[model samples]
Target: MEPEQQPNNSVVVVMVPLTAQSHLNKLLQFAKIISSRGVPVYYMGSTMHNRQAKDRVHGWDPSTISNIHFHDCQLQLPQVITPHHDLYFSKMFPLHLLPILIQLREPLSSLLRSLSATARRVVVVHDSLMSFAAEEASLISNVEAYYCFHCVSVFALLYLQWEAFGKPIDQGLQGGDIIPRDLPRVSFEGCFPEDFSEYAAQNIQWSMLDVGNIYNSCYAIEGRFLDLMAQHQSDKMLWAIGPTNPVAFDSSAGVHHKCLEWLDKQPQSSVVYVSFGTTTSLSDAQIATDGLDICNDEVIKQRFIWVLRDATDGLDICNDEVIKAQLPNGFEERTKRVGMIVREWAPQLQILAHSSTGGFLSHCGWNSCMESLSMGVPIAAWPMHSDQPRNTMLVTEVLKVGLVVLKSLI
Candidate 1:
């Protein structure tokens, strides 16, 4: 591995994500793309997070790429809290991530300075959630920071134009906020709790210091929202560079062939791929809801591949007894011939791109949405929490490529 200090007098780009699985995955892909074009890219995060991102990254390996580097910001994280399955994802954000966010500013500032000292022009791209890093980047004269929004442009526009929608920031929301009356009546409860809104509101100001904003979407997917955002914040530049994951699978990376093999046997456009993103899991009651659908003769006859996160509380536990108990009696045996239940991680991109993948029943996480769209697979949107409902709106309401499976899981 090369040392952190690169040769002097050259332009460099620094990538800083929120250090979550989804956020790190997207930023690493962006870094790879930037490095392929001859720009030296540094992916900055904690040692554990950096390892997790690199180890799980699909498509390309960063080790073989010369210009792409990993810089560890050595900050001791507190013992993280395990989230409860019954609570929505947004409700647990402060408990799990707030400590890490609080401690990152010092290390991030120092790293930005060290990198800036050696490079002629330093471009730092940090997640919108990590506005503190962008604040630090603004302090250095040679450094330019851009906010990479993890959610779709539409999700942002709703909050950015909250006042325009007749909801003043001072009043705050009752339960949580809702979309403008003209748009579909979707709520931010999926990602925003009322208690956390004030904190998020405060950090949004730091984003004003950034040079511009970036999205993991194209004008085609969010053209109107992107245009509206540009007009709303005309002072800053906007770039819609997205579908950052590899367009095609790289087999040499040791792709998971079981999912692909099952898809090959199904007729073209005959299968429905079902998976919620990593963190979101269904409760036992919800599992029974799925069993009812599977029991329907019309549905049971069709080929289906479902990734069931057997972990009850999003822990590492994979209890087969718990999984079987949640399902309807004979659910597994009845569908054994036509259905495949994946108890572990299934290769998503390869499944979405397969000829037999006609639809995706997804949580509408931005990464999954982009991958499915890029592969021309439609969606059956079932959002869990945190920017997901809004992303679901983008998929169902605006893009017209998918439909809402349910408004609320509860």
Candidate 2:
């Protein structure tokens, strides 16, 4: 390692996001926001993720966005052989991440030393899931680490702490079970698995104990919960500088432009844009009963553009046979003139920002929630799993900017 380079009046922020699209989107947006203010950002991720990040940055002018840099830290791991692929990847991620961080320390220190004397501080910002690795690496590298909660709310973080340290709550409580006063409006049945909760609580506790925290929410939306957390954990620094929608870095490609053009043709405030974020998948039965039934409605069918992304299973949802089989008989032909069904990823932010977009039908993921709100579009929340149900409450009850739809209805 090199001698400590202590400069003044400049900041070099190192950001490490979990190798997932939603997580990367939030972190990259934050990186852009900070870099725009003259700070330099060193974004670390895998080769593929770095490529995606670079592509997102390509939309911005190089002269204005020149401070953001990408670093590839690809991991070497054996082929996974598990049915629970996401779980397997999550478990294996830190093993790969730690080694990369170890290798990065000396070079990062050298880069800091090479900077002008005004470059004073080096802060490492990491996803909450990588708390363990980041905490350890920051200690070794002598950089300040801040954990970014990219997905869940600050209230969820407090609930995790309460679950871990406070009086033990029943893990198998039903949906209507009353939550303790200290916790947020969350249902036990809607919570994640017990094992997942345990893991999250452990890591979140580590983050709270060892590092500062960053939340991807603004004070207007979650100020009460943020205040509660700050009061409870007075020793640490917590910042809520978000609703971090990367509107400035959105791609202006032909495909995206085509989507905008289609929206432009529609009447203002007439279209309802529907998407379930990136990870959630609709079952065949759910697709037939829920999707078809909703589109079959006379009013909605005319002004809806549903984005049915088949990302989880890699299924070809765009195929005619696949669409016909999944939807009700003669459904597509009947709604051909009225509605549009996009079988892959759509430009969600762009669509939301369009004048014709009246509302959003979303799975209540934090990123989707932020994007919808940022665009001033109302939400029709249909939460599925993880922290979504709580997010739905935030949207419908707290913010009063959206409605909650029962899962059975959609």
Candidate 3:
């Protein structure tokens, strides 16, 4: 691999997710695209937990092609703050980001102003939640900007961008910034209307997650007065690129099927890999936070590979210790003979695509949904947050391919 040139300018991409689930995944995909093209991509986020993951994409050998340079440019904590548990503080990045832009816009802009300023142009791609600040940074810096929506453009236009798209900048929410109203507010169902063109395909799994749910298909989903509000910017400057999460079982680069390598070496399709996705530590909004904890002890008499985290606090572990304690039971000893590999860090896509992989146990994040769909694998949807219930709605309710363990109860 060719070493990267000392970039003359940089494109700062920020993903300041109010809540860090599928939103972060979207920003990373865009960073991957820009980096794939050899642009200098500096991704930023509000919290360190999210930022640490942002730090890892640069060294990704997934495709055996490393073209992106990752850097952390935005920090939003430990200052001017309204404290809350996993909730998002929107003002942290922008109110503070403007100050940083003053320092960065000049020299960096001068260097990347030209297409061939001895380096790739500095572009800013932010998650929709934080794109307004990125937009401000781009205006002063004279660089390009884009927003990454890992799911469909629907939620990107509505849910994440609700404040920017729905409410005027000056108007405070009905509740303070921390408490997002429980009712569905912003709507974009009409803007990104459903296109069921893929329904004809034989492998219906790729179409597992619906655009309707991803973007909130309700008619009330879009902002009311969009035409006038929309013209604030030119179509050429702003972009909605990538719903680009490419994966394959046959190896070429980005991600290939080597699940078999691990599963093949191990045992049967008995092992189960679980990852609700990064943003699910907080209680899921749509699904009841109750009953979303670990499964009950009845093992179905099978060996397993469970990919879980220490999410007891969020799952209400103290109140739900019975469920937790039952996890390592008489079945584990007997099941251990069947073999069990438990981990918090598993190559999930690889695990799901394995030949011996009997099935998947997922929280139904769109990316993970698509991964399983691309592999035509079935799952046990344990949806955990905002659109996850909706995304899971598409998975189990619409597709009829997967099963929800406790749907009647949740």
**RMSD, every candidate, angstroms:** 4.9, 6.7, 12.6
Residue 286 accuracy (lDDT) in model 2: 67
| Model 3 TM | 0.54
* lDDT for position 237 in model 3: 30
| Model 1 / residue 275 / CA error / Å | 1.2
* Backbone N/Cα/C clashes per model: 2, 0, 13
Q: What is the C-alpha lDDT of each candidate?
A: 0.71, 0.62, 0.41
Give the range where candidate 3 is weakest over 10 consecutive residues by summed lDDT: 209-218
| Minimal lDDT window, size 10, model 1 | 311-320
Choose 2 or 3, whichever is better by lDDT.
Answer: 2
Top-TM-score candidate index? 1
What TM-score fits each model? Answer: 0.85, 0.76, 0.54
| lDDT of candidate 3 over 1-410, digit per residue (tens) | 12234455643333233223344455565557666665545444333434444433321442343544433333333232222323421211123223332343333333233323334344444333333434343444344443423344233223334443556433423333311234224323322112311111211232222121112122222233122123432242323333344445444433333333446666656665555554333222321232223322243544455543333211121132312211332534644554454423346666666666767777666667766776667878875443455555555654567888544213
RMSD of 2: 6.7
Winning model by lDDT: 1
